[model samples]
Target: MTVPLVFAAVFMWAMWDPTETLEDLPVALVNNDIAAGTGADRLAAGDEVAQTLLDSGALKFDAVDSDTAKAGLAAGDYYFVVSIPSNFSTTLSGIGGKTTAPALISITYNDNNTLLASSIGDSVMTAIRAEVVKGTAGSSVKTVVAGLDELSSGIREAATGSGQLHDGTSELSAGASELAKGLQNELVPGTAEAADGGRQLADGTGQLASGLTDLRAGTDELGAGATELADGIESIVGGVDAKGIAAQLAALKRALPNDPSLRGVVDELTGVVDGLAQLSSGSREIANQLTDPNADYRSGVNELVAGSIELNDGANELSTGLGQLNTGAQEAATGAAQLADGANQLDAGAGELSAGLSDGARQAPELGDDVAQQSLADLLATPVDTKASNVAAAQFNGPGAAPLLLILLTALVPLIVFMCCKPLRASASQPRRMSLRTWLRRVAFVGGVSLLASAACTAIVWVALSPSPDPAELGKTLLMVAAATLMHTAVIAVMFAIGGYVVGAVTALAGIMLQMFTFGGVWMIETVPGLLKWLNPIMPMTYVREGFISSFNGSPGFWSALVIVVGIGVVATGVHLLLVRERAPHDEPLAAGSQPA
Candidate 1:
């Protein structure tokens, strides 16, 4: 009773709340990292990481130099040593720069102290890595998000500018189109008409020049005719004198004064002479006026001929100028037509440009405020958030190890009981019929005692370690213990019955070792050696441990494990029965009252 209880107590005490010892577990921390960046941007990544680990309270960390840390780890003063190299800060700081390799946090551990220490160190390093990655990645993401925000703003501004440009281009296209229409529909035809008019005017001017030349020649002839007429009149006036004619008329009248008829003749002749004198005076005045150098008629005819000649020369020049102008106008009209075509193309191109710019402006994105941007950055930085549901998590190492210890204790009970109690008591006086009955009775007695011992060990473990709180789970655990105890008891009994004391003891011890090794109490079955893994399926204690753990955790698999355990127990019991029956027939008659060996 004391032996099994003592074993349980020792195992529970050793394994109880192992993590609690981490608070005092000494580890070395060495920071050889230099600061990165300049002035205000300088960052001491090593110091920061050290501080984080120190604050985490995960383990007892002793800040030490490199040599000291190494010596301490070798001498078993420290379980593990975490060292930050000089490039840690520089490498981490240069994340987006040329640095492609990851910043390393070196972990050195000494398994001489405890192999578990190395595992613990690995776990700690993993946590440190995660924290460092989170900080660095979050910062990088924030910067990227901020840049994205700026890019968004720039895009929005560009969109606005594009919209304005589109509006301006739209107006320009419309104006260009109107200019092209005016040039094509109005200016071109007008220029052509002007060219036609110029041609017509040239022809008219040429005709006018010819007419003016003819008029000038006629004027010159008129001037010469006027002069000749004036000269002829003057000569006639010089030939006849008016005064002489008047005197002759008077003398003729005096001679004819003697008779009345003669006097009538004299009066008529005097009138005639008076008329002749008046005619002669008028002719003389006309000749004088025509022959005068300063006369208005002669000067006017000369001036008119000179003006007509000048006019003729001007008309010829005008005709030549009109012909040149007509040619120029024709060229201008052709240029205008080409310009109109170019303007029309320009209008169409500008319209398309405007439409394209407008579409681009409409398609541009808009980003919100700083707060929203930051939230998005954080989300992108750490996209996944994990949640764990620990269904039947153990709070401490003691409770977690309770099932293994309990199963071990239960298995040991049969070994302890069978060590003192004999499985078979045969004698020559004992009849063959009593052999089966006697074996049954001994099995029942041993099994009952083993069950009691298993329950007592379980109670001791529960009271000492506080393995579980649920009454139902505890009851199931007890049931698993009872089943395991019965199975072990049957196995030990059969071994003793078939092989006797020495063989039974050796077989029971070996079976216990095999079961314990393969049951995954110390290590997981998958992690065990090949032989152990193969034996794990057949080991009754493996199911016992499984059932115990299942029941303790209030999970499934208890019933299946219980069934397998009971079946193994039944098989062992049947084998024991068969051995007992076979031996019953072979038993020689021992002297009456003599005990069986």
Candidate 2:
């Protein structure tokens, strides 16, 4: 009884509430991360994470340098070491920059120290990663919110500017329309009238040139006539001898009579001769003035004729240019009309653009308030929070494992009993055969003692561990233990009866190991090897362990597993009765009451 209890005590004590002792497990935390950004944007992610782990009390985390952490982990002073690199914060802060890389948190574990230590480190790292992600995401979102606020402001200003632009464009379009209309209606028609006037002026200038040419010819004839008349008069004056004739008239007047009337008639004849001389002199002066190169009349007439000819040529050129100008004006009128239409279209487009900008400004989100923006950022960063619940939660590891230990201890009782004792008390040399009823009674007595011993071992472990406080669960577990004890006892009895004590002991120990391996004790059934898996369903320990576990967990498999365990015990006992038969009369020893060689 003490032997089974001693083994159970050692196993239970080792596995009892392992998680509760996690704080005693030494783990090194090495923080090498440099702060990222400056001033308001500064973040010390490694320090923050290290502090959180320390404060959480999840594991005993010792803050140490990298060398210390490594030495401690190697020397088994620490179960695991968590190291945050120098670029941790910097890499996290680079999320929105031109280049980005994942922030690495390294965890090193020594499986030699403890196999489960690595799994614990993995869990701790996962939690730390989540926290880092939340913090970094929140910061990134805040930056995005700030940018959006600035964007909204810029859009509002643009909307106002666009509105002003629309107004300006409206005035510009109106002015352009007026200019186009003036060009088309007033300027174009006025240019055409001016061209017509230019053509008429050219015709008038041509006429004036022709008239001047005729006047020039007439002036030439007049100059020639004047010269001829002057020459004839000068000759007449020379030939007539006007002065001598005047003297002769005066003499004749004196010879005729000294009377006043005779003298007056001679004087009148003299006056006529003198007047003819004066006319010849005036004609010579007029001819000289008309024909002289230095005279104004001849020069003026020549200049006038040359000027008219040049004027007429200029007028002809002006008329041709005016005709071209008129054609150009007509084209300009059509172009101006098109320009006015284009300006109107431009104004319409500007109005639409202004309205679009205004609508955009109105629709833009208002993220200006810092308080509201931060709150929004935080909400967006961590959208979902998880709350976990376990329906069949175990308080400690000891209570959940008590059933497996009880089953193991109970199985040990029958093996130890059968190792020293025989299955049947009758001697092999006996000639008379023992009745089945007597044989069963002898076996029942031994089985009863083994069952009592098994019950005591199981009860001791159950009470010490207090696997379940409920009387119903304890009762069910004890019933399964009784069935397991009987099954092991029958099975081991058959082996010892057939193969003697040494073989029976070896086979019993081997069966125990095999049962443990296949019955979800050392490893789960699914993970066990294929040969073991095939033997798992038939193993008596399988139902016994399952029944005990089901009873503790308050589940449905207890009754079914209990029935199976009882059935296997019945079969093993039947096989033991059939296989280990009493020796026959001839098969007995040669001498009665003597042992067989």
Candidate 3:
């Protein structure tokens, strides 16, 4: 019942639109003026505006009996009224119907309800005055005419609104039908397909994130080491000027058993004087190394990067080729299936041919029961026909996903195992762990192995796939892959070395979780909330994935991704080395996760 009343109220409001009530008022008809009087004529026009206002429901008015109205006005039962004088109607009928109607209505009102009273009195008087000017077309008539115009306009507006609503409804109806059609044609299946895609994207992103996190941790360490290196360089360069190269060298020789071959050999060997000279010479060497664009380590880094670019191209080509081959094989399988279908059809035709042969045999002269009759007919008889038989069975050959996964696993196992071993060299006992030199050798060896493995795998996959991507684009792709893979491996391996399998495993899992849920590369990133978007940068996959996309397309974004990748790699490698060097024997596997007391 409440609901019905609420609905009724809403309907009423809609029908009597407030604007209509306020802007135009409906008036009840009242013909009080004497028929022949000018006052009556003027009052007629006043009546019209009142009537129009009444009809619009814009305002409410009553043409009460004069006797009744006067009584109501005195008793305060009525707000106001238009009292037409006796000659009111006669004036409007005369020739000056043009400018005479506006001033004729004699108005009466209570002054107490000041505002309401003013509006009523003013409106009535205005209508009467307009009447003499435009016959009965006084202010009220003009207002009514305006209201009539509004009515027409309202009708047009209603039609426009209805049209829009009709279109909207039609669209909605079509959408509903299409929705049903989509359900029938694609929605259900597409949803399942999209779900599967989402799952895959999630998984891919997870892997990327884990890889990236490991890389980022590594980069942080590398950055720390770099800061230290830069500081040392500043100290060294401050120690000696470029001109003191020989004298510095000579002093360094006296302080050392060997020749002054530490940094600037012969140049630092000239005669020297002060105590600050030695420190200065040493500082100069450090500064020179830091400042020189062609320093050994920096040059090596550049070379490594260049090699990475080549590697990236190769990897991209491989991935692309592999993708194409997968597509082609699918097509080939379909073609083979079609061929098998054709062969089956041929076999069916052969069976029909065999049936035809049987029919022909029955009509053959000797085989038929008409031998005697055939003796006369034999002279005109034709030889029997025969057709070939079908003897082959249809077969289909194609690979499925499982076998491919297995093959992939088999190929990657060596690299994975190699990564596991390379990082453990630091902790090895005996001569291997005897000195800093030995440790350095181990680090270099492992780093070299990881790099070589990455390059070789990239090359193999690229060559095998033969993607035929543009060379430059292809190169960038391979570099991205190699950089990402090596960086991830180093970071993960470092974790394994520092905290054992558990720490590495946990980090890997966390990375995967973030990748699947937070980052948006595999799906619409913008769909995620602001909080997630903010968190996205923290995921290592964010950087690597972007780099991968950039590299894949040979887009301008390649450099940015490359920088991030390298940064992660450096940090990972540095942190791993530093942790291994400074590790305490009692540090637990869960140390990072554990809160200090």
Candidate 4:
């Protein structure tokens, strides 16, 4: 009895605070990792992971060289060993650079240890991996955030430059528009007016040339009339000389009768001769003046003809020049208008582009601030957190597994007692009969004692724990425990009753061992191997644990466990009844039979 109690106590205690003792686990740490470079590249990921482990008190780090760690693991001195490669930090630092190989940390654990110990080591390694990833990713993210800030600054500068360009183009466009207005409103009209004046001047010059030509012809006719007048005067002078005026007058007075009429005629003739001579002299002077090249009339006429020809040529040249000037002015005006349009278009396009750049610059500060505040690693971090929550919290350090403990104790104690006190068999003597009632009564007594044991153990545990459980939960716990105890004792009794002492004890022990492994009373069944998980549903202890936890914590699976445990007991009892028979070849039924005959 004492041996069974001790066994159950120790087994339950071992799994009670499995996670709490992890800090005491022996792990050999070999930090061979080095920094990537000096100064800025001095990020060491492995060192950071090791420091975090030390700071958080997550593990008992036994710092040692690689050789010592490896030897210790081989000799079973250490449960597991962690080794960081020399290029670990370097590879991590070059993540986005040219490096392609993924950084790795090697975990060497002893396979000779128990499966539970190895599983614990695996969990620790997973934590270390998380720490390394967080540190490395955080460092790389800071650099990317810095680069974003610089890009934003460059965008702002570009916007400023574009704005200046727009201002300059706007001024150019205004100037060109003004020039076009001048051409249309002032210069074009002024040029047309000047051209009209040139046309008028040309007409005036044409009139002057014609008037001068008429003056030249009138001078030629005046000179010809003067010459004819001179010829007439000379003829008059010749006739006076032929008449010998004074002598002729004297002869005529002697030969005449001296009449008063004849005398008057002679006197008038004398006066006429004198006047003819004077007129002849005057006519000769006029002819000389008219024919002379130096005279005013001939010289004036020659100068007028030469001047008129010059004026005609000059007027034609002036008219031609004015026509060309008008054409040139029109071409210049058209060109100015085209230039103004082009400049205005250039200014408008530049202004719009500059506005877009300014808007971008305005937004750049907010974007940079947002990017600078957040680290890329924080956004992209992948963290693993393992939580071991107890649905039915343990009352004491080692009594949380009370349900499993009670089951094991009930089965073992009964089987051991059955083997030690071997009951006698019935003889084939006078009137032997099977007594099912007596067998049931004996099984009931053992079940009652098993219930008492389970209740007493739970009470003791409850008193020992800090902040004792509520009364409601305690009452439920007792009821679930009592049911488990009855089922366990009944099953064991049936096995012993059907299959004698040795066979029954061996079968009970084997079943208890399988239940310990399959029942998920310690670690989660999912984390265990597939074989153990597969056996979980079939094990009776699995239901016992589930029922106890459900009762205490208000979890599910209590009904299922109760039904399965009751079914198992009934099946065992039925099997015992069928197997039990009169194997002694009795001739008569026995009156009182404690065992099968």
Candidate 5:
């Protein structure tokens, strides 16, 4: 009984409160860090760290002179001395290195004084270092987040620009597409047709050219003939004058009338002479028409030659224009193809950029939420920040006391009952224990008594600590305490039934030790060693501790805890009744005896 009480007291004293040891621990802090640069680039990391530590209230930090801190460590007056180097802010802020060098921190410890205390001091320094890094990173994250915000703004602007570009390109593509279609369907074909017509015209002009050359040769022949006719007519006219022609005709007529036979001959001769004169006059008129200078065959031939030359020139120009048109048509088709392809590529690129920007806009709200409280420079410099939050917080100084007390009561209650109570017997005279039913009834009575005691303790802790202000949470606390107590009574009573009083007391001590290692009442179960974590699910106190935290914090997991605690009691009772082999022989009375090792 005394042993169980002592064990409970020691366990409670060691881990009843959270963070108290860390808060009260004496440590010396010295800040010698200073900014190396001027303006906004300047930063004092040591002073910032000191301010954060003070704000968080995570440590019992003392600002002391460097020499005094060093003396204190040597004299065992302080756990350790923490001195911030002169280059602390300069190195961390990278004002000197421009991000080429990493920040460095130095801690001095007197391990000879107390190794555990020194280790703890080192841990505290590590935590301070972490806090400093967090603050610095938050500043940097604020800068980066701001830059991201600006980038997002820029992307949105770019998206707007891209949309306008898309519209312009779409119209361009449409025009290019139509141009390509026209080249393929109309202009190129029409140009080919015009080229064909030009070829036909060229051929016709060549034939006309040949015809003109023939006509020119023919005109030369006609001129030569006309000149010969004119010369012949002139010669004939010169020989036959009008007066001589008339006298000749008269003589012929006079001769014809004189001679009868001669008359016939004379008449024929006159007719012949008259015919010759008429032919000569006609020849002169023909010569005059052919040789006239103002409007004659020669001038007409010259005009014809000029017209043929003009026609030939015009045919050549048409052929040349058609050739250029054909070439231009092909070039236009090629250009349209290139334009369409370029427009398509531009449209695709713009669309992708726009889509990516839209997605980034969609995600901006979440990112903005993360860096809402930070600044632009900090976000840019340090883009990531790490933080921690507890879902089920103790929130009070003595919230852990309930779980710690519950664990104690679980062991100590049974120890006290067994030490104080009398054993069940069939009768006073016989002094032998009754059947297993008698044992169970006595265990039930002890459980009832333990429940009342546990409830009372729970109420006391609730009123004093007010771990949870809610009425529902207080009710849950009472439930957990009662369940834990009943289970403790069942398990310890079962141990006594199976192995007597010593085993019961030893079982209680063992249970407390298991609870100490496996229970998450003080340190989180996740932070414990692997083996202890492995045993965490198996320990009944694990559930009780979890239940207490949940109840106080208004979280879940109470039902699960209640189920496990009740199951433990039921199983323990069953094991006690069925599995225990008492030391007494068969058909003999049950009596107290030592358990097997």
Candidate 6:
């Protein structure tokens, strides 16, 4: 019993070998990436290749001492060793100013493991190098792109410079000819003309400098105007927090007279209040929008502020018009009250004018359209759009390339389960007595198994996350992990029902690898061969990984993918059961005691 238990434990551990760390591999890494970038966080681009290679579990490392590292290939231990050159990051300029860099990783391997080691090193190194190149492809491509742009600009400037030289030479020739002709006519006049020309040249420099100053000032003024507009918008938003509109509406209601017809008065007040509510809502939207502007250039904001100035100017005009009308109505009311001190007769005509003025005053609702324009201006003026998406991506993807723990957990658990249970085998009575109790038991069993899968997988996932990680970011990642675990269980459950442990485990593994290539988008999907590419949706891991990513990002794709993957798993399980039933072996029974007699 003790021997069997030991054997079983060892078997279980081997089947569920969870020791997936970079330290397990047999490769040597030396980081010598030295690139020029201003910021501390600016990618030391070359180390990325070495780091990725380390991430793959193919290589085992024996630390290279400084002496050996400098000398090139180290003494025995590693199958292959990588040495990155010191000038790995610096841009190269070949003869004729052609831009390219020579960032070579010299890989040397021992002769003992040459063929196998070379093959492994090559495959792993190829994948890592591809990613490093692709991830910073923007920088590389930008070098050429920017160089081309600069070259084009330089060429245009050179063309203009050539024109300037031609013009100056022509002027000089004409001036020289004139001077010679004048000298032939006589001396003092030509010399005096030369002095005048020198004075004009001096004036030309002064004028050119003045023109440049003017250009600078005009730009400064535009910038200042934009800043002022932005400041004004900030002030407005700060002044009118969410409480502002409600406060104002309450104040206005408080100010309204409580008439004999209370309902009429309340109704009248409510109408104005509704309009105010709308205006307030619109203002809030505008304020929110100002926090993130769409324009690439700050100058674009200037245009918006200029539009605001126009709008404010229009509002001032409207305000003035309202004031005049109010004044006129008061005068009319005063005249009517005095004329008819003894009667209500004057009230009617005064009321008529008052109504007209009130109606005119209510036109302030239209002010919102103009105010909304100001909001757009506010957004433009603020220049809040920041170009930091790459920074954000690096923050997330840089420190770690992937969740290897999850990858291993996903890879290993099914293997263990399948081996332990010896996978599913078809039987004759499988389809005969399908009942509600059977269905319920199967579901319960699947649920129990799923819970176990989640527990087992999540331990690995949480262990990986235990090391310091951005809390907010890791929270999202954990959510994705949880979702994926559930997804994996659902797939496992359904597959287990139809095909049992062995077949399900094998198929699931295949699906995961396929996803790693095609669906993980690890390699360029477009580069995948047409025949092989069709396998993407068929791969369960494709759905699992995409679903997880989408969930973390709050994408609808996650939910949609979840439904599809779960649904497929469930359907496939039933199909698997049907196939199993058909293939099941039946043992024919004979008379019970006949053999004994």
- Specify the highest-lDDT model's number: 2
Higher TM-score: candidate 5 or 6?
5
lDDT of 2 by residue, 499-529 (tens): 5556567666767866776665434444344
Residues 515-558, candidate 6, lDDT per residue (tens digit)?
Answer: 55555334323334454457666766566555544433233355
C-alpha TM-scores of all predictions: 0.37, 0.39, 0.26, 0.38, 0.47, 0.30
Predictions in order: lDDT: 0.64, 0.68, 0.45, 0.63, 0.61, 0.46
Displacement of the residue 260 alpha carbon in candidate 3, Å: 99
Clashing pairs in 1: 428-590
TM-score of 1: 0.37
The local distance difference test score of model 6 is 0.46
lDDT of 3 at 359: 47
Evaluated with TM-score, which candidate comes out highest? 5
- Give the alpha carbon lDDT tens digit for every residue of 284-389 in model 5: 5554444543446656656677777788779979988998998899899888888888888887777777777666555443334543434334433442222222
lDDT of 1 by residue, 90-127 (tens): 87665433334566777775322232455555665666
Q: Write the per-residue lDDT of candidate 4 for residues 450-501, one digit (tens) a residue.
A: 5666666667656764444442256555666666666666676665654555
Error of 1 at 548 (Å): 1.9
Root-mean-square deviation of candidate 1 = 16.0
The residue-level lDDT of candidate 1 at 288 comes to 41
Which regions in candidate 1 have their CA more than 4 angstroms from the true location? Answer: 1-397, 425-434, 467-472, 584-597
Candidate 5 wrong stretches, greater than 4 Å: 1-186, 222-242, 247-295, 306-310, 340-413, 416-420, 423-597
At residue 545, candidate 3 shows an lDDT of: 54
Clashing pairs in 2: none
